[model samples]
Target: MNSPTAPRRDDRPQDDRTAHRTILLRGGDVHSPADPFATAMVVERGQVAWVGSEGAADAFADGVEEVVDLQGALVTPAFTDAHVHTTSTGLTLTGLDLTGARTREEAIAEVRAHAAAHPADPVLLGHGWDAARWPDDRPPTRAELDGATGGRPLYLSRVDVHSAVVTTALLDLVPGVADRPGYAPDAPLTRDAHHAVRAAAYAAVTPEQRTRAQRAALRHAVSLGIGSVHECAGPEISGEDDFTALLRLAREEPGPRVVGYWAEQVAGARDAEKIRALGAVGAAGDLFVDGALGSHTACLHEPYADRDHTGTAYLDAAAVASHVAACTEAGLQAGFHAIGDAAVTAVVDGVRAAAEKTGLARVRAARHRVEHAEMLTPETIAAFAELGLTASVQPAFDALWGGDDGMYAQRLGTERARTLNPYAALLRTGVPLAFGSDSPVTPLDPWGTVRAAAFHRTPAHRVSVRAGFTAHTRGGWRAVGRDDAGVLVPGAPADYAVWRTDSLVVQAPDDRVARWSTDPRSGTPGLPDLTPGADLPVCLRTVVDGRTVFVRPDE
Candidate 1:
């Protein structure tokens, strides 16, 4: 598939240092997840200096500084979500969204029009709110949010932040949460009483409203072509000054490229210097050994085929072997959030007993990770390929909860809900997958997460579309160690995505080859429209990092 005129080879570095501005791009159709199709790259000052064809643009026409051409469309790369929360998807894009509220009286008329246009108070907070497509499947009480917020103190949330639906003046401001322990005398609020009213409305917002809800969730992940994000952030309910105020407001804004991950819980990983100042800013995020399979509290090794429960293991194996030996002796690269199968065999026996009490080549050179090894068990996917770890998944939660009347066959009934999120049985047991959109609990669309890991609505968990676009580009930059951020060629990182088809590399038998070219008003159904398509028409005219940050509306 390398034809624009094929004859390329520029593998970078030949420096006499001064020929930098190149772009070129030429007659498009490049895919390069290390080739699944398309071809013709080039770039330069941002990296990827020359991929082939279109007669390799006359060998970069004496160091061309701009070419672009692309009369073919469909390039790739620029998509790396790998788990997100980026200031709760930028505070669910400035709150009161109610995602696609089908009912609970249309999510209480969108929280009574955002508590009557923000009537100053400690209570009007709102969030996603899907009482499983309510029609009385129940969830809006607290006397129906105190008769549509008139008594103020409302709360909302519940598109799986594991529950929250407060009111009654936020249950009289959290007093004895109707007898706690994930409260539910007929679900008064919910799960740990809506995780204490969503940790007191995310600790009473402000820090300039959490930097304007994380720059409106990094401008909706750079108008949906993503780039990078792993934020995660929970530390007993977000702190470390909310991930150093979202990495100092994403290093003084110009969005996307976050990678934070410090949701510790499980007794805050026995604070070994706050897990080495959250692995001193570079091993890129993780921590959590259970909870989430829509809060049945994932930690299963049998016992959730219609609940008599057998989950919930948030650390206990000598506190996840002393927080994976204090995050692998402080150089940090540990992750955990295992989605049951006894929390992926208690985090693969706590990272194989913290790599045999420290020293499996210093925990495989600190590349450790697990986060949602969903419900694996081919001996925990061959112990995640004999402990090189890193799974960090979320194939759009198996295309919106792998259907056939979803929610894992009504809560784990169909043979342990046919092991969700296997990603082709963890890449045929060599295990090392990565792709995420846990964003405000899913909807960040890396091409609808590579079409739900390539149409894997359970056909034994599909996977292919060049293994879901190299698990969302270079296995999410080698799960955050970032070897030059996802690929393109020459020297990487000129971050990509051009596609209005070539369909993320010829795997389109359905999802009409990565859909979207229209439809996005948050109807929230398989998002794609970063608008461009009209017969080979993808857009992003200039998302260049050496200069242009998102440009397409005809450039």
Candidate 2:
């Protein structure tokens, strides 16, 4: 229960306990994102104690234990990824990665190379193949993968993580799966069938492998200027054991902080107890209302332009309302993964019903959130603002598969697709926005997220660069009910990143550079110009709660 100005405790003398082990970062542009003129910062214990000009360092030097020269590196609050899969993203770091695969044949070739390297793996597990950008606009079929692995059990997930393809041998492991809903003979599995296949595919990994995977993911987050990550865990996405292991690792080991959310459709006391037992922040984080659009499973109001399917719904309005009400009554956050207008409408209806059942004040106090509210109308946005909903969105989704000739345009026609992910409109309507990269699905790049938000495919929906930076930084902390974190103010958590960067603006002036400077309109400072082609900063250090989670070695 530390106050805003209370310093963290230490075993030092009474006079020193209030401010122990202070360190000053000098000669750097301290763009707390809110404070543009601060050229120096003081980190005491695990909190920011002071921020001022570099000349002020000497005033605190007597009590300070260390003074590190920044050499003009940009210092700012570390990033937080709102929605991420812990082990799944980790496995991609060590397993088959097809993000560079340009064609269907190239994707299969990567599988062949991985199979050749690991001839003894029980089941081949990999992800990140997208057919949307391929010339043929098709993914590698089970037959193609079987040829790569010589008929061995294999499961390859799509970039969206909503659909996956499994070889016959792997499909055989889950008996009678072909007869279930969302089953195709030898093509990619979607909906229920895909979940079953994915579970079966991952069973081959032992506990040791799972631990390594989680570690790899955390370390990667640290190197990328990320201090914390919200793990979107579910029974379908990653089982209870995987979630438990991840939380335990963050608690015991030195790495990025992890806030766990169990994505379960809780309807009663029993489910609430389950979430409490798991020590979760909420009962929803990808609690699927529907699947992803790339998989042709999002619960859209209209049928797909290229196909006759209208998409699927895992939870109806009643289910959503019941879950939100129960979670609200039990003093926990409720969230859902909703991607289509139909699903968005259902969620809005459910929120309204929950407000009637449990007082709107109580519902708002819980600070319930929604993931990927990508397709929303004006009414839906208004409901979100009324209910105090936090829209945990990924702007990178649009950068990768949006615009005139993208996957969204192919599935949904150009007119319908053009209206997706209205970030600016959401902000204007007072819906709190938090930006993130749903890593592995999209790479975990905070700068890239900000760039995409500022430069959206739809010009009218673009947010200011300052707004995008705030969403990725302070807004992420607010989404998890921690207004005290993610800023560089005194008494805030000493969670920040030091970066090695070049030009701060897109078109640099010949005489001067625009480092973490401010835009005249809002007065809030912006991060380095993160436009698509500009060079992003390199992380030199990442500190979380005053501990050095990552530091680049002098090479």
Candidate 3:
């Protein structure tokens, strides 16, 4: 590693920016591929200057302006969440959250309390209530919600965000929503009706509220050691105004970097230009090819075990091909929200067609993404690798609902559930895997996400801790076409986090490999112990571009 030499006294400026651009952090374990046993690192001008042992660090101790004693902490690359809904996540942070409610009664009680507390609010919005977790598997009815809110307008989204239940007052805001597809007089709304009501509810949020929510979400992410987040904004998800506002907020603030994606289909250069004008990196993310499985709306080849229907299909293969071709031609990334088997099949066939229509090299070079590719087949997984599609997945999905009795099994039967989120298969086939939390649907817990993948409910899908960590960090950067960021190495972006952790150990999907690599002679770096039920590492500090973004309180 090359160390930065000190400038002469005459060349060194008195200005803080010039003098303090270099910082040396020593006396800690640095997780870096550059040096597996790295003990110290130097950051200069928002980039990693060098990484070496403690003795080597002494050579340039006086050259840097600031010296930090890491005091045995573990330093690793800050995480990048590949899929996120910024404003909505913020709203959940500031508004009502029903993630902890176990039964229908508990969810109703929480809603009533929130409505009573915020009496003056125009529309009460809440998220993360799963009927599948309830004893009777019954969602809160519209009548029950009406009584809970005392006729106040309310919209409560299911855990998946694919469907929601609303009070009649909120329903009144969307004209003819009752006649929309997937609408029922009693149960939670799905498909078109769910989208209509969700839009109406979010429209009621004031500009100030929206800003507060966005700030809260970003702040929460940075505090958890997340350095960057990809905002998956779209027309049906959150309007153009909301998406642009979030990008502006992230730019003006000193928080995690926000890479925006407008999930809109493109026809040609004009559409791509419009997306770029909105400050988006791609015209991709959450462009719904199908809804989520929890709502029984994920497009499947066969009928769901519980439901007689095969679920919803928002976009067909032809439409997906057209979108992919347009994006490839325009040099913009095209992606979709596909979860079910049929939806995954459509994405594979469509991208294959696009690669044939547009030059395969160009299509592959774009590195387009697929969000929540949960139910992938071996064929589709192979196609993803062939087409160079990045799987921006949330491992927390499996943690929350992937066991024998979890929601996946309930919806798709135990046999099909085992096939969901085949990370091992995808990785083995050379498909790029980018991990995310899909916050608001699942909380932004980076370490938890890594652990979930490392200790997947299905043993066949689990990956090593190191691989999982890389998927959460560097893989996200690669998805955004950035090869130099998201790692601790010379000339790479100085985005990292300091953690208070237990003894580091090499953990793998197989116990034998983990045991064999524990010796220092193995040259394998270690991460915090992530055995099931073990306490996760705590973020002591998070830095982005050589600037500290979060410092744990009372540390």
The predictions' CA RMSDs to the true structure, in order, are: 21.6, 4.3, 4.7
> Candidate 1 — what's its lDDT?
0.65
Q: Please give, for residues 1-555, the per-residue lDDT of candidate 2 as tens digits.
A: 111111122221222332345889999878764465678999997889998888766799788888889988889899988999989988999889888899998999889999999998899998999998999988888778889999999988999999998898998999889888989986789988998999998888889999999999999999989988999998989888999989888877767778889998787888888997986878878999988889999999999988898799988888889999999887778999999999988888898799999999888877788999999888899999999889999999999989989999999999999999999999889988888788789988888888888889988788877678779888888887878777899988888999888844322222122233333344344367676688888899998777777899871
Worst 10 residues of 3 by lDDT: 1-10
lDDT for each residue of candidate 1 in 1-555, tens digit (9 for 90 to 100): 111111122232332222256667767667554443335777776677767667646866877757777677766667778787777777777777686888788888778778888888565666676655566756676776777778877667666565676767666667787777777644534446667767776777778888888888877776666766777676544677878777667655555566666656323345545644553332224455666765567767677766797767757656666676676676566676767677778777877887898877777666677776778868878877887787988877766666766777666876667767778878878777888877877777776677667677677777655567678877876775655557677777676756454332233334333443323232211213222332322446324343444556754
Arrange candidates by TM-score, highest first: which order? 3, 2, 1
Model 3 C-alpha lDDT per residue in residues 137-216, reported as the tens digit of each score: 99998899999999999999998999999999999999999889989999989999999999999999989999999999
**Which candidate has the highest lDDT of all?**
3
Candidate 2's C-alpha lDDT?
A: 0.84
Residue 413 in candidate 3 has what lDDT?
97
TM-scores for every predicted model? 0.34, 0.93, 0.96
| lDDT sort, best first | 3, 2, 1
Error of 3 at 327 (Å): 0.7
How far residue 361's Cα lies from its native spot in candidate 1, in Å, is 35
